[model samples]
Target: MGETYGLLSLLPIAVVVITAIITKKVIEPLILGTVVGAILLYGFSFFPNWVGDLLATMSDPDVVWTMVIPALFGILIAMFGQSNAGTAFRELAIKYVKNKQNSLLATYIFGIIIFMDEYMNALLIGGTMRNLTDKFKVPREVLAYVTNSTGTPVSVLLPFSSWAVFLMGLYGSSELLDGDGFTTYLSTIPFMVYPMITLIIVLLFIFRKVPMTKYVKEAVARAEKGNLFPEGSGPDTEGFEDELEENSGNTKKPRLINFVLPIIVLVAGTIMFDMDLIIGVILAIVTCFILYRLNGTMTYSELFDTSVKGIQDMVELIVLIIAIFLLVRVNENLGTIEYVITSVEPLITPLLLPGITLLVVAFLGFTTGNYWGTMGIVLPIILPLTQMSDVNTSLVLGAMVSGGVFGSHVCFFGDAVTLTSASTQVSNMSQIRVSFPYALAGLILSFFIFLGLGLIV
Candidate 1:
């Protein structure tokens, strides 16, 4: 679409990032950037045409399916709260996870277990564990860091996940790869250094092996003083508290099954049927309705009402996801990534390609706040580059995955970051400010590791 724009193609991405940083609001910037991209692509006369295109894109069955799944999952999350299952789980967690170290460890473990979808992982874990972590004076930011770290990283590492399936599709369709897409993806797992090292960093934080950033330190200190969140550091948790109180009044005791059974159904259904996450979550939601109704904890009407409320809760995030999709379409049309890659192609060497690819993908992810988009744009380009050079294909592929994870992990306006913050009640910028140092550490470590591996392999 941007056969003639060249470097001017990057303006939309620049507008998105700069506007987001200045305004601390994601939706407006994303919409604005998308409109700007449309204007850039088709000129002043195409605004009406662009509107038609956006409507068509958003209404496409595949787009609607992807957008609705996360929102449906949100209903399951809210069901947990409505059933008081989250509170019951928290009480159980408090019984066993007594100290800060164990709480952090448990958080990490749960994050890893919910690896099928990053959105579900962040929302479920962050929501379920925030109160527990606060009991031990662990900042919401720390909870966010732990939860966010395990999300996309774990999803990409685990071959059974949606992320793996998506990557496999990308590879299978590409002309460069020789073997089965699933096989290639499994092979690349071990070499995903950014995600691997990022997990290590989380462990170090849990074990007190790594020094906390200044912001994190202040958060910890404030939390120790019984202030779970620093003043003005995050959003209000009053709505969450009210929701919990409303649910906790149910006469029936909250059972752990309310939490465990649904997650089991979700995960197991996905694995057993080789299905999309939407199907697993749908099965889980049906299971929840039966269990809750049969146990006298919720009536059919109340369950229906609560499920609607849950979907309502996710409306903002759903809109944000749609905006991200639109922005991605805009970038695709603008050829921003093509311009970026071609601009840097001449300077790449076999020894430097891995590191450079990692940096470039990470930069794109950071700027675009869209990991899937970054991977979609960069992988095809980078994979071909690797085949033409003396580069190790697996290592380069690993770097690509790592860079996407790194960007999603650290990008302030990223979907994962925003989801984690909302789930934990932390402000977007607060989470970003606290987690940036750790993400930076992982990025630097990955860059050097890939550079060395590129040279050796």
Candidate 2:
């Protein structure tokens, strides 16, 4: 259960990736990985006991709270779409964004502006922009890619975001760091090559400078043929479209206020009240309901049903998140992360440490599908290594952040990917397949950037 197992602790992650590639499925691989990790942690005799422990961990108040925030956000998104606020916004956006290029650009801008929380950014922006992107034949996969890439990357880059606050606390508490944690975080910003490069890469895609991948090209081709989704690959929006149609018969017009005001309340509430994302979303949902009802846009019963429908739409994503949480728990109990760090200790040097740490953290984050968890486990270990190895602290810190961002963007089961898929109504695997090449391109670029910085800094 500790670092005593050394390299053997990596078997679970290997199992996950190999199984996933072979099966082309995520849930089974994740479950298999978790079970293997449990067996490794507790042995054959206590394997049943480990399952009980995992369940108990998943039910912890903090864990449940984290899970609920996304579910509530899902409800808010569903309400937006159901109330035709998303449609209204799309119509409004189309006025300024007359073509595919401007539509994608507009989506990216919204992602940057909603940087307070990654989950909110993905759900709100993805939901609002999907119809607009559809109008221009900009493929759901492309929309998913834009929303997914910008979600975590933008949050990590912004100083006022949840990511920054969590990282500040992490760095502040670390004995290895010498200066104020906030200042140290700020210093690492310039060296955060991955997210910065990721944004640039997205911009290139928006401007049509980057070539579309095969999947994206196919998606675009299909859209040109008047197909919104590839054959057999659309979200289960059975009741969603029906509800929107029913609401269309109402006398109230689809004003931009229905879309804009709720988001303002959600963002402002989060910052001003220092509220949890769940609270902010709850307030937004209430505001949307009040506005829609007062304007006679939707009946009270219709609003309640649509909100529930929205929550139902996110059921798959919520389940994926819980499964991932269990996988993370199993990884912790198996000490997989600790093994990776300690195994790399003997090979690290001042010049190579930054690039090496970035790779290792990236591997862990990609495997675990939880970048925040990767950071929590990795920074504590790698920061101490940097203190003793004569490495440039800021560069190493930047590398860690870069790796986390890259992993979040690429991992198929990562929260950002799942949430983006759910919000944009694209399948999770479709989003990953289309976006993998681009993410890899960024990762390769980041590795070289870090390697050069490692030598100079």
Q: Pairing residues by index, what is the TM-score of model 2?
A: 0.68
When summed lDDT is taken over every stretch of 10 residues in candidate 2, the lowest stretch is: 237-246
lDDT of 2 by residue, 1-457 (tens): 5467666677766776677556656566767777877777778755687678667756765456655665676677666656666456556667798898999998998788667567667766776787788888888878989998987888888765557755765565455578755678889999899999899999998887899887887888888988877554675732234333354443446677887898888877766765445567778889988999998888899899988886786676555555556666666667665666667678767777888878887887676675665665566567657877877888999999999998888888777887787777777788888788998899888988888987788
In candidate 1, the residue pairs with backbone N, CA or C atoms under 3 Å apart (3 or more residues apart, or in different chains) clash, namely: none
Weakest 10 consecutive residues, lDDT, candidate 1? 238-247
The lDDT leader among the candidates is: 1
In candidate 1, what are the lDDT values of residues 363-439, reduced to their tens digit? 86787676665675566557757876758899989988888898888887778887788777777787888778889
TM-score of each: 0.75, 0.68
C-alpha local distance difference test of each model:
0.76, 0.74
Off by over 4 Å in 1: 59-62, 114-152, 155-191, 211-252, 325-342, 360-401, 404-436, 453-457
lDDT of model 2 at residue 251? 42
